[model samples]
Structure formats: C-alpha cells, structure tokens
Target: MYESVLVATDGSDSADRAVDAALDLASVFDATLYAVSVVDTRRYGDSALSGTEDIVSDLETQANELLDAVEKRADGGVMTELRHGKPHAEISDYATAIDADLLVLGNRGRESGEVIGSTAERIVRFVDRPVLTI
Candidate 1:
C-alpha cells in the first residue's frame, strides 16, 4: 500500500538489514525507495575547533559511502540522501518532506544497544508516518 518508502541507515549491520527489508517492501509495492544517511552534527561542539572541519568532512564522506552502498545494493533502484544535523531530527524531517508512506530503519544504529537506537525511537514516537524497525 505504500507509494514511497524511506530508510535511514548508519552503515551498521542492523541498518543493512533494514535496507534489505526496505528494498523488499518497496519492490513488493512498486514504491519509490529512499535511502538516507545522516551526519550527526551534534557530535561536534557549538564552535568549530581546529580539527572540527576534518571530523565533519570525514563524517560526510562516511555518509556518502553508506548511501552509495545502499544504492549499489538496491541496483540503482533507490534514491539516496546525505543529511546533516541530529540523526532523529533530520530523518524525521526528511520523511515528512518526502511525504513518505512508510519509514524503515534499524532498531539499533551504530551507537546504541540492540534493543532500540535513540534515533529510531525518536522517529517512531515523533514522526507521523508508519515506522518499521528491523
């Protein structure tokens, strides 16, 4: 029943699972699949330090690679986005902006336990769309 599906990835194993699941779901429904990797800007302080640029650049590069992997795995069937800001906030805002019919994400991202990643939890509780966490 979905027309557009969004999946947020962090290059984690769980996120990889979510990507596969999202792809399958999108294929089943003939829906558009969107893959997003957010660069958590909060990791950096309010002011830019000497090496802050390097860190952000590295994060952005990582995010690009992650999105690249998702697109590759999807065989160019998915649209990818690289965002900057809080993971939950950016992902949630993107889903809303895309008017996604469904949101798929890993239960746990790179930084959280196996139960539920903070980003995933926040999106589930705050986003208006249906969320499926793997």
Candidate 2:
C-alpha cells in the first residue's frame, strides 16, 4: 500500500536485487519509484588522499549510470537521484524529504562485513520508515 517507494543502491549486485524488488512493489502498488545512490565522501578523506575529486566524480558517474539502468527497467513513473554523503544519512533524509512510504535497500553491500554493512544497519536504526531488505 505504498504511494512513493525509494530504493537505495550502491551499484552492487545486492543493491541491484533491491532495485528489482522495489520495482516489483512499485508496479504492484502503482506507486512512484525513486532511486537513489549515495557516494560515500568519507572514503576520499580517509584514504591516502589523491585524486579525491576525480574519485568522487567517478563514483557519481557510476552511480548515475546505475540509476539510469534501474530507471530503464522500471515500469514507469520513476525518478532517480544521486547524492554525496554517508549512505544511511542521505537515504533517510531523502525518504523524509519525499515522504516515501517505503525504503528498499540491500541487506549487505560489496564492502559489508560479517555482521552487516554500516549503511544498511545505520539506516535501519535511524529511519522511522519501513525498509525492505533484498
């Protein structure tokens, strides 16, 4: 019974699955789909610090492409967004801003650990919205 569905992706396989799941739900509910990709700016600052802008730009470009791919697969009435910040914070903020009915994301990411990726876990903790993990 969602009206607006937000899917957060990181261009990973798990995120792709999440996108697919979100798309299915959107199709079923006839809801608007919003895809978002968050670039982790902290990595550039924490690493050895070279080609930071280039790296961030590259990430943004990749994220845009990924979102475009998802948009192509969507049934219709879908929009995409690309942001730079902590993944969880950005996704949550976007959900709040859009008044999304549901937020979909991967249970784990490419860089996830034994416990859980910080982004997924943090989003679950911080957001009051319903989250569907794929």
Candidate 3:
C-alpha cells in the first residue's frame, strides 16, 4: 500500500487524467497526496537575461493555479509544491524529497502530444521510484 503519492502536472488534460488516477490510488490506500508543477527554466531559448524574470513569474503563477486545482480535485489531504527547473528532474527530486511511495505522471505533457514527453521519459528512466504513467 502506498503511504505517499506524488503527481506531476503541467496543467494539461492528460495530466488531469494522471491526477485523477493518483487521487484514486491515494484515496484507496489512505495515502498522502502531493501535487507538483515545475516551471521549465529553459524558456527564452537564448539570452537568459532578457525578460526571464517576467517569464518565470508568469509561469509560476500559472503553475500554482494548476496545483491549486489539482488539490481541489483530491478527496484527501494534499500538499502542493511549485518548482523551477527541468520538469523531470524537479519531479523526481520532489518524490525523493518527500520519500514518496509512488510517482504518478501522464505519458505526455502540455508540450508534447502523440509522443511521450521527454520529462516522463527521463523520470521513468532516472528516478528510483515506482512510476505509474497514465
């Protein structure tokens, strides 16, 4: 049985499905639920100093809103976290930080469709956790 479940979302519909799945599992196991949204810092594509702060600010705001929605959808206690970094790295690190019993994510994110996203791929490969991709 899972004691702690972490779900990473990019505010996408696919991720919403993952959230639903994570919430269901957590409820069944009476586990703690954690929702994390990471703002990819790789934006701007070039000059890091050019409006980076504004971009990150906007991204974080959006991410927090998404996390809020995820928490709202859960039936049990939920802890939400917002991070800025590589999506997969942040998600994996959070899972380890919380000693999560399970890591749940969607096969694709907001940026990727018709193919598995790179974040899901890396987290599945690098994280030492039981990942359940929906």
Candidate 4:
C-alpha cells in the first residue's frame, strides 16, 4: 500500500540488513524506493572546525560511494540523497520533505551494537509517520 518507502543507512552491517528488508518490502508493494544517508557534522566541531569543510566533503564522498553500493544492491529502482546534519533529524526531515509512505530503518546504526540505535530511537520519537525497523 506504500507509494514511497525510504530507508536510512550508514553502510554498516545492521543497516545493510535493513536495506535488504526495505528493498523487499518496496518490491512487494511496488513502491518507489528512496535511500538516504546522513553525514553528521557534529563530528567536526570546535578546533576540528578548521577542517570541518574538508571532513564534511570527505563524508559526502564516502556517503555517495556507499549509496552507490546500496543502489546496486537494491536491484529495483531507487532514488538516493545525502545530507549533513544530525542523523535522526535529517532522516525525519527528508522523509517529510519527500512525503514518503513508510520509513524502514535498521535496529542499530554504525555506533550502536545494542538492540536499538540512538538515532533510530530519536527518529521514532520525532517522526510522525510509521517506521519499520529491521
């Protein structure tokens, strides 16, 4: 029943698992797939601000590279976007901006080895749409 399905990834194993799940759901529903990756700019704060631009640039490069891999793996049609901001906020905002029907996310993100990642939890709290975590 979904028209647009968006999935967020950080190129981690967990996110990769979620990617597969999202892809399957989109395929089954015949929905458009949208992939999103966020480059957290907070990593380059304070004294690191001097090289923040360069770091952000590098992150974008890496993000695009990862997104390319994701596109290839998706097999089906997929649109991708990269943004610089807090992961949860950017993801939620992007979902709303794109008017996605569903959000599919990993149970854990890059830094989270637990049952649930902080970013995913924040997204659940901030986002008004339905979320499916794999």
Model 2 C-alpha lDDT versus the unseen true structure: 0.86
lDDT of 1: 0.90
Q: Each candidate: RMSD to true structure?
A: 1.4, 1.9, 1.6, 1.5
Candidate with top TM-score is 1
**Model 3: colliding residue pairs:** none
Report the C-alpha displacement of residue 93, candidate 2, in angstroms: 0.3
1 against 2, candidate with superior TM-score: 1
lDDT of 4 by residue, 1-134 (tens): 89999999898887888889888989999999999999887766657856557777788998998788879988638999999888999999999999999999987877777888899888887899999887
- lDDT scores of the candidates, listed in order: 0.90, 0.86, 0.88, 0.88
lDDT of 2 at 95: 95
The reply for model 3, stretches above 4 Å from the true place, is: 46-50
Give the runs in model 1 whose Cα sits over 4 Å from its true position. Answer: 48-51
lDDT of 3 by residue, 13-126 (tens): 789999999999998998999999998877555477355678778888999889989877874379999998788888988999999999999999887866788888999999
Estimate the TM-score of every prediction. Answer: 0.94, 0.91, 0.92, 0.92
The 10-residue segment with the lowest total lDDT in model 2: 44-53
Cα lDDT tens digits, model 2, 20-107, are 8998899899899999998887876756345556777788898889888887888445788899877888899999999999999988
Q: What is the lDDT of candidate 4?
A: 0.88
